[model samples]
Target chain A: MKNLQIFCVIGSLFVLTACRKRLDSFLFNNDNSIIEYKLDSYGGELALDIPIDYLVPNNDIHLFEYQIEDEGEDLNISAIFVGDLNKISSDTVILYCHGNKDHMDHYWPRQKLLSHLGEQGRFGVLMFDYPGYGLSEGEPTEQNMYESTNGAMKWLKNNGLSDDRLVIYGYSLGSAPATKSVGDQSFVLSPSKLILEAPFASSSVMVQDASILNMPASYFVNTKIENAEQIKKCEVPFYWLHGINDDFLSIESHGRTVYKNHSESWKQKNEVPGANHSDVPTFMGLEVYSDSILSFITK
Target chain B: MVLVVGISACGPAKFVEPLKKFENAIAIDVGGPMVTIPDVASMPIPFSSITYGHGWSDKLTLHGSWYTTAAIFGVAQIGAGATYGVWKSKRQKHGISAMLGFNTAFDVYEKNFKFWPQLDAHYYFKYNYKGEQQEDLLTKNGRKRSNLLYVGVGTWYELEGVKAHGEKQQDIVVPMLNIGHDLNWKKWTLKTEVKLIAPFSSNENIVLDYVSLTGDKGSTGVYLGLIRKF
Candidate 1:
């Protein structure tokens, strides 16, 4: 019995160690690679109707790469900023954190729609690829995600943007960095307001959804990006948007929990009907979606 | 995070045929629902359980099981059940059994737990049985050999009034259907089973990619068990 007990303990430890997966690999589907971001030229599935004037030439679209340290190694992070760089100091900027899809090329049209938020180029919208995404170098870790978003914020700050004028918006997986930037005290800059679309509550919620039970997230994943808890510390005016029909992360389990947990003073919620995970913008119609965000920014 | 939780009670039927009075058996089972891992082929999640059964009478057996997989994941899960033989042939070639059971899981993380009440019934047919203890059928172990094939239907009730994050729990009762074969070698039995879990529950909207033959509903589970009879 003693020998059997020892074997059982060792076997349990081995199983525990082997079963855990770094959820970033599964959560972030950053598989596609591109030599250049062919924004309008590359026809992707999801698109919004933007006026021809709002295209690349009319907007000051800057495609640049910034450097960040990932575990002591220097990695290049790719970014795209829309609107006039010269007016960044005076303009309110929205940093668009894209979801866990392929790359920025797939999200270019969405950011283009944001560029026309209040009026064409009224607010500079900046979006970047997380590490191992698109043209960015190094593997995509949860730490690297926060660091990359911080790197983008630092770049915007270097170009004369301030916290009060910075608006951080995250969708789906991007909610991790966006919530962290505002909620985490150690973060470089806290944005004036926070916006999340179809945000998942936490890794544990995902595990619960998968199991339909209160199974611990540590069983299968080590990523502890709990946006629900983070939103409690976020005192900024919060804007929560979710699709009623979000199948990947249920609105009730993922989005509503995050929205409800925000103990902050000012908050707004938009529960769109007939919208899935990635189609909230298109489902709400481009003009309506853009106008809704404008109202939040001005509020 | 597609950890297969719905297959939490998956193991061989506690007893296809109840043992004679005072007999006992211990079993170890492993396997679970199939899930398609991203960039990897579909496979079973390998949930495991250890069960012990004791015969109280010729017609009834009591059983309990510890969920080894859940324990490994830091969740304590256990189940208890009783099987009553409803009918049996004079030659012991066929039998019918009914079982009632419950499995509960508790996690220390948030002090959260859940209970599922279960009911199952099985019909079994025994074949190629040798009466003598010295008879060797498939192996050289000098043990009486027999084979039992059983088909069963079961359902587990979700007792929680609310789902994760206060969502009204819609699926209260999940149904399952299973078919299994047990090879008996006197004091040893090897069991293999295939189950259709939640045959009517929609697989859509869940993060895991379940390989279900029931169109868009339900998932298939596979299990293997070894039993030592005393």
Candidate 2:
């Protein structure tokens, strides 16, 4: 039995090693050599037409798209600034980081909503795509995403954006970089204002908890994702959001552990009654969610 | 060794109505010598050599083979065999079939892995080798090695995806044992073979073709091929 257990452990390790290599090879090399990206499909030579439906934040809002203040190569990042610029009485900037998959185009609606809060808009909103995402070059990695986000804050500082004007907001998978980028500080802009939406506790936990996979025991997998505990050091306003019916990544994991860590956390969670990952925006009613943002930013 | 078992009554004087009817028939379907498998005439079958075969107790084996590509293949004769089955599959005249058993048979039994620069004329026969190991195969058996020749029609097995090479041959290792349909075509015999251990890289079930005369590798590789009789 001991030998069998040892074998299982060793085999799982090899499997994981192979999987990581496969992922790396797939990302870097043309091992499966064939280009799928159609140059024509991604905004080719067509004359630029500033989207008519482009987001326009309320009176106090000011959108600024700036590059991170970095000299390093390939760390390019751009922001989708939102919120009321004039009413940003608070010096804090909310860097609303997004998840993998898709681009800024799909989230224009959320951009519009952020603009809805006249005074909220004043608290600058910054978000950029990692390499290989949106218009960014190269590919995204957990390590680089953190580096990229840190550079953004550095840019903000060089350009008069301060720690007081820095609030990190990560949604779903983006929560990792958001929580990690916060470093060791509190008050305002430091991972200070964490709003994790339907977050995954860890990749290992997700793999183990998945229903479609032949997941091994939790103890067998070792991935580092200490979100809730790590955030305990955060001495700032933290909020948790999880739809009631989150079919993917279950709200149980994203919600319970997140809210459980706080002695006085300003937490707001619900199943959204009958909502899934995709419909969270509609079920929660944008206006109500938008008001919460206004109150938080103003506060 | 092929075992020829004749079910008959043992007696000097046989009954008027013999239990076994000796059937001797010759079938020659030569319609104006309708084009033989292309490239066959141009193939080279060096030398027709015959080597001695030996057995093993698992440690080793004895292999033997004789080939002739002659002027057709620029090969006068080539004979090689290992104590262990060299790894190969073939068919010859006279209905006798047997796989040089593993651990105790000839090692050079497999025709593949030979690494010979010469090519062999092949007489391929495959049909009802049991199961639906059928059509959807287009191959051209005529390259030297690692190179591609032409593409043909039909198939021996379902391994016809390669752009070149005839099939896997464990010539350097143990020759493969063969078990498949009898693609019996006149005096010229075409055959397919199988190996107990195939390379770990391949995802397809593979087999090799043994042309009685001269033939080379196919562009489709061993996945598919063609053979003709003289």
Models 1 onward score TM values of: 0.79, 0.44
TM-score of chain B of 1: 0.91
Candidate closest to the true structure, highest lDDT: 1
lDDT of 2: 0.37
lDDT of 1 by residue, A2-22 (tens): 999958964664454334233
Compute the lDDT of residue B88 as modeled in candidate 1. 90
Alpha-carbon deviation at A286 in model 1, angstroms: 1.4
**lDDT of candidate 1 at residue B208, scale 0 to 100:** 77
Lowest lDDT sum, 10 consecutive residues, model 2 chain A, at A25-34
B1-230, model 2: which lDDT tens digit per residue?
00010001000000100011221111111001011223344221111222223333331333323221111222222233222212223431112112221110111212112122211112223233322222224222431211111111111111122111111221222111212222333222232222111121221110112222112211111111122322
Candidate 2: segments with Cα more than 4 A from true spot:
A1-72, A83-92, A118-122, A183-189, A211-225, A263-266, B1-230
Candidate 1 Cα outliers beyond 4 Å, as residue runs: A1-24, A32-36, A41-54, A70-74, A263-266, B1-30, B36-43, B48-90, B94-123, B127-145, B151-177, B183-190, B198-202, B211-218, B225-230
Scored against the true structure, residue A163 in model 1 reaches a CA lDDT of 90
